[model samples]
Target chain A: MLQYSEKVLELFTNPKNVGTMDGDDPHVGTGVIGSPECGDVMQLQILVDDQGVIQDAKFKTFGCGSAIASSSLATEWLKGKTLDEAMAIQNVHLAEELELPPVKKHCSVLAEDAIKAAIEDFQKKLEGRTDKAELHSPRCCEKLNDCEGCGSHGE
Target chain B: MKLPIYMDYNATTPVDPRVFEAMKPWFCEDFGNAASRSHVFGWKAETAVAESRETIANLLGASPQEIVFTSGATESDNLAIKGICEMYAPDGGHIITCMTEHKAVLDTCKYLETKGYEVTYLKPDTEGRVSAQQVADEIREDTVLVTLMLANNETGAVHPIAEIGKVVREYRARLHSHLFFHTDATQGISKIPFNVNEMAVDLLSFSSHKMYGPKGIGALYVRRRDPRVRLAIQTHGGGHERNMRSGTLNTPSIVGFAKACELAAAEMENNVAKLRHLRDHLEQGILQNVDYVKRNGHKTERLCNTANLSFGYIEGESLMLKLRDIAVSSGSACTSASLEPSFVLRAMDVPDILAHSSLRFSLGCYNDLAEIDYVVEKVATAVRELRELSPLYDMALRDNTTGDTDWAQAD
Candidate 1:
């Protein structure tokens, strides 16, 4: 078994705020990151108020134990924080807090990217932008997958 | 019973008390090299080794002379594949095997490939059985060996080795004549019914640890008559094991292996029935209670002690963590120190999501109905909990949560 921290195991077994929070609600900013191939797919949604403060955060992650723990921690950190404060939550910080091994650090990166993408989606609605907001850049190898003749891959 | 029950019997089984008792003498008072001909210790050790060899041979319906002891199934596999390839390399360098074989066989074939040998890895059907026709189609004049697994470790899909054996037998008599057949029956030997003559496998491999015997001991069945299959020796020392393999024999483990095989031969019928009862009950309960669950492998042809299931929308790693009371395996390669989904399930064309969601729960002689009940209840609960946390499952339940999101446009 992977050496998951106790907190990671606890949050995974009893993840907080797992269900969706009215995706149609204008105050909701939903961010879906990750892919099936990468073995992680996270959809994080935030409930923000007029003060630009996150009132509540909920998520659903389809991945391994660490991925679920990472997204769960992201949601827990998102609630009650100002948008700027939430933005400051880096993947590295999450990795350190979760004590995730280097191989699993990408799960934390997905969590952080989900935060940015969700915030951008909410701001896009606020600006009345009709075009869909671009989400996270696919991590490393998944990015170069579309290019031919370049077999070099990221870890 | 221990709180966290061991359900991963396919991985390795605990040594039976009888086997342990049989081995204790060899490890202590009877400790002597079988090759020592001058003393009573050597005679006693050789007697024990001969008896154990007879026991293993009896279980597989082969002669005692045909059984050559090795460290374990991995060594048996390496010895069989490489030995056969080396023996016939001057005449033929082509071998045929399947993709789902244990790494021992696959990696050995790969090493042979580096030495200018050709190998054909046949793909199994959805149920994980490589057909006899597939093997027959690949066999050629240069095909010196055909190595296939008798039972898959992950799915427990029992290949029709008898059918494949028939094909090889026909080819050996009518065509190539020198083409030999070997099977890594590491998962099959005592767990399922097997006879070397019926399977027509010239050489066969099996491990002791997988059959309630001690680890670090196994055997390779070599044909002695009817064309008399041959292999080049991999380990050259002491000129033991009929010049096929050379090393000081593991007397204790061999004795233990024989004891385990004797017990299995005596009790296999009843144990298999009990295991089947518990396995079927668990499979039915989990399937009836859980949602989007699919069973891998053949419905009836699988081993009675094995059950491989894919619980959709639930990550197998998370499920294993939550179902802590029942030890089992997941498709997550993290457990195996990798990140790839199970290649066995991938070969079956199970979707990536379900493949990652797969779990292998292998029942054993020690397991009872109560433990099966524990697994059925705990697994259903765990799957429900993980699916609740799963976004795809949640979105699947809620009709249009993703109506506006464009997945392809993310790039």
Candidate 2:
């Protein structure tokens, strides 16, 4: 039998936030990774604020106990961090938190990747809004005095 | 400490107390090489060896002259399969076997295939069983042998060897009638009846370790009058076992094996009945307490002491780790590498999710009702908890039928 770390076993025996949630929420960023062929799958969701800070996170995993525990622990850790903070979270830090065995380090790595991936999605969407605002600036419409009242500038 | 339950009877068995007693003297004061002629040492060794051979032959219903001893069932299987192939290679050159045969037979067949012998591997259906008619259908004019396991190691599904043998005999009436029938009876010896003539097998393999005897020893039964069956000698040191297998016999282990066979023969009916009762009780308890559990193998044709289950949505390795107090095996103990599920289950077309969740509980001589009950409780709790945490379970529970929830679909 594989000897699990105390924290991994604890989380495995009593996993936290282990169910599906609404990933389409305005505040939530979703990250889904791993294939069924690989024998491990995880779906992570993070609730973040307008200020790019994470308020809460949850996950559902289809894998061995180590993978399940890693996702559970990863979600709990990401709940109070800023998006950048979550982005900076390393797989090693998650592994250490769970004391994961070397063989199961991949599970922790998956957890970290899912975190970074979700945060990056939020950052990308934030950047898209800024780029759209800049493209429609009033300074660029100086010659068009009635541009404010004109919802459609051209037919 | 509580005695850890021994459910790995297929791996090896505890030496029976009586067999151990019979073997004690041969290890010490009476030790001598049976082949050393013209001395008290030789006489004593010869007497012990001959008596042991007679005891074993009686159990198999064969003359002592037909039994050839080897290191174990592995060597016995090798000597039977390869030896026959080598003897008739240039003239006859073909063999037939099932995919579910033990490594001893399968590997030997593989080696033979590489050495220019054509081997046709028959695949069993989803139930892990093959029809005798299938064997008859596959037989060709060039085929020299038909070998199948008397009972499968993982599923414990018994093959219709006697029927298959009868078909082979009818089809190959003459032409050297070079067709030989061999069954690896290692798993079937004590649990099921094995009459060589009744089974119509020309060659049969039996091992001691699987039947409450010492390891590193076993025997092969050959019909002395059969001109169609003879092995090309592989080992040639001192020409022992009528020049078939050549090694100085370990008297103590063989003696223990013989005694174990005698005891098994005597207690066959009683033990089979008791083990079946205990086995069914364990199965019933799990079925009563756990949902989405499935039994593997043929319900009626399976070994009396064996049962395998697939705990839907739970990994077998996790369940095994949780139930550390009890020892058990997954399907194909050798082939089922860690977390890989089982090849046998895969061949049966069992879905990968459920295959990975399979567990085997094999009962033995020492297990009783108390042990069975305790195992049932631990397994139920562990499987239930494991299933509750599985996302696959949540998806499966929705339909109440466990349809493949895009589980096997690769992304």
Candidate 3:
């Protein structure tokens, strides 16, 4: 049996905001990161306002318990923080907070990476609008093609 | 909640308090090398080792002279299988064994295959029980030895060794004129009755840790009458275990093992009865609560303490995660890294998906009825939840969540 941290086990058994959110909502910044080979996949959606402050966050994870718990904790920490503050959430810090063992620390790293990737996508979109307003108007949806939240490829 | 309820008894066991008490003195003031035959200090150590050897021999109904100690079951198995092969290398150059045997036996056979020797790997039925007739059928003109395990570690399927022994005896007279039989009875000594005479086996292996004793110690039983049951030493060192195994004997561990063997001989009947009852209770409870559950191995020939089940559409690892508080095993612990289903299940012809979705509960003497009931409920709930979330289940049922599948009820 894999030894789970008490906090991680608690979070896994009773995860918060376990379902999906509407990523199209204007108030949220959605983060979805996954590598196909590892099979550790997750979808994270954080709702944020014009002030760059996160309002709400939700996730749907499809991996081990540590992966689920790590993603859940990442979302909970994202709420009430600015985009820059949320970007600062490191995988090592989350691992320390959850008391994850060395092997499971990768899960926390994945969660941290997901948050950063999501924020980077949001920043790219905002920057594209300022660089070329007319070109960026209808291209926001087109930009989503490169950013696969959770990286799940539909058959 | 008692935090963790350990159910991986096959891996190892907690030392019994009685055995620990018996060994405490040997670690301190009584510590002396058993090999030293010069003075009073050596005499005491030799006496302790001899007495322990006698006590262990008594438990297995073998003479004290026939008992030879080794590191553990793995070493005992290696010494018994490889040792005999090396000794008879010039003569009967063949070995026979089943596919479901432990890695100790299987790997040894594989290594022997690389050497110049004929080997036959017999396959068992769906129940994992190897037939005695199968052994008789596989025997060749120059077959030297037949090494089979008394019971399987995963499914707890007891082989027909007694019947196999009868066949071996007949073949012994025809072929090499003295074919020896060996059994890795590591998981069978105390859990079940094992009389070498009744089984007619030349060599039998037993592990101390399997019966609530300390680790790193085990013994092999060699039938005294069989002069042809000779084996070459696998290692060269200071002569020990009549020069077959070489190492300064671990006196404290030997003493603990002896005491544990004695206790097991005295309490095995009661312990087995209790374990069997608790095992059945848990099995019945799970069947009553959960649907689509399939059992693996023989219905009646299964060990009294083990119950293996397959809950379709859900992986056992995910189910184990859900029921983290209950500490039961699922397939091979090593295979967890690759997430491959148990090879034992595959050998039994179980489908890959169903094999991955299996779990095993091996009850111990310390486990009570309450723990069994509690675990049953927890396991049922976890299996149900995992099944509900499984896309495979959804596809199999064609998205019909309300209509219950009859597969569970039939099983």
Candidate 4:
């Protein structure tokens, strides 16, 4: 058996914030990372408030005990943090905190990737909403009528 | 019942108490080098060693002169493969083996390849079986040796060695060439019926630890009649074991190994029946309670005490961690230093996902029905719990598929 720290074992046995959020919700961001072929796949989701603070976080992982513990601890650390603060959390921090050996360092790397991907998804969602709003606005309509380069609107 | 149940007997078995008792005198009271032939102590040790050799030889249906003791099965395999290759280098330089063979044999063949020897590694079918026809087809004029295993360690799939042996013998006679057959019977020695004569095996390798004996002792059976097998000595010093293996005999472990063989031969039938019943109960319970579980290996031709299963949508190491009270092994890459699943499972064409989810439960003589029952309950519960936490399981439930994600997109 791999020597795991007490904290890692505790989190793995009774992980915090483990579930799925509505990916369709504009306030919810979903990040899926890793591959099943490699024996690890993690899906992390976060519910962000209007002020861009993470109100809730959840994760589901199919991997080793260290991967599960890494993602579980990632969710616990993500709750109530700002998107920037969550981005600041690196894999080394998780590896150090979990006392993971070198062989299990990839699990922490996956956790970090999941955190970044969720933040990117949330940012992309905000940008997509802005674009949609601008497309339906009177100003965008006026610009569309004047611009011949807007081929879809001209047709 | 013990809190942590042992079900990984394929890895290694606990030494039997009776075998230990038989070996205790040799460790202290009869401590003398068997080669020191001038004294009473040497004579006593030599006599004990000869008796142990006779017992081991009897179990394998061979004479005492044919058995050559070594450190363990690994050393025996190296000796048989490399020894034969070097001895017959003048006649031929080709060998045939399976991809699912143990590393001891596979790596030795690989090392031979570096020395300009040609080796044909045949792939096994989905049930981890290679046919005799395949062996016959691969035999070339230059093929001097055909080495395959009696049973796979990971999946417990028994190969048809007798048929392969017949094919090799036929080719040897028809072509009037020097062709030999060997089998590493470490896993199948005591669990199944095996006779060197019936199998037509020229060289056979087996270990004591896998059969409830002390570790650090094993033997290789070299045929001395019909078609006498000559092997170039791999170890050269002091001329021990008839100038094949050159090391002082481990008297205590050899005695323990002989006792283990005697006990296994006596109680094999009853033990096999009981182990089969317990193994089937465990397999059935898990199959009935869990979804998306696939049993690996040949369904009917497998070892009675082995059950290799792949539970979908859950990683094997995660499940093993959850089922900590039950000792078992997994094919998952996460369990090893390498990032690949068991090569034996891969050779059998098990997909990467399923291979990562595989577990091997090997029962032993000491395990009881009640322990199997506990394991079943624990496994079912742990699988259910892990599935709940697995995103892949959720995806499977949503789409009604096997949760197989395209690797190109999953990245």
Predicted candidate 3 versus true structure: per-residue lDDT over B288-338, tens digit per residue: 888778788887787888888877666666678887777777762212644
Listed per model in order, the count of residue pairs whose N, CA or C atoms clash below 3 Å is 0, 0, 7, 0
In model 4, what are the clashing residue pairs, if there are any?
A: none
Best by DockQ: 1
**Superposed Cα deviation of residue B107, candidate 3 (Å):** 1.4
Give the range of the ten consecutive residues with the poorest summed lDDT in model 2 chain B: B331-340
- Model 1, A1-155: lDDT tens digits are 67788888888877877878876677888888876655678889999999999999999888878889999899998989999998899988888888887667767877888898889878887887645533343652363243232223221
User: What value does the TM-score of chain B take for model 4?
Assistant: 0.97
lDDT of 4 by residue, B275-381 (tens): 89998888888877776887789888889999999988999998899988889999998787666688999998898888999999999999998998888888889
Winner of 2 and 4 under DockQ? 4
lDDT value, residue B57 of candidate 1: 96
In order, what lDDT does every prediction score?
0.83, 0.76, 0.76, 0.88
> Which one wins on lDDT?
4
lDDT of 2 by residue, A1-155 (tens): 45778887788778897766565455667676554334455667787887777878887766666778889988888878887678888878988888776556667766776776667655655555321101112321231232222222221
Cα deviation of B170, candidate 2, in Å: 1.9
Error of 4 at A23 (Å): 0.6
Q: In candidate 4, how many Å is residue B61 off?
A: 0.8
Q: Give the alpha carbon lDDT tens digit for every residue of A45-84 in model 4.
A: 9999999999999999899899899999999999999999
**B249-331 per-residue lDDT for model 1 (tens digits):** 88999999999999989998998899899888888888777867778888788888888888766677878888877889987
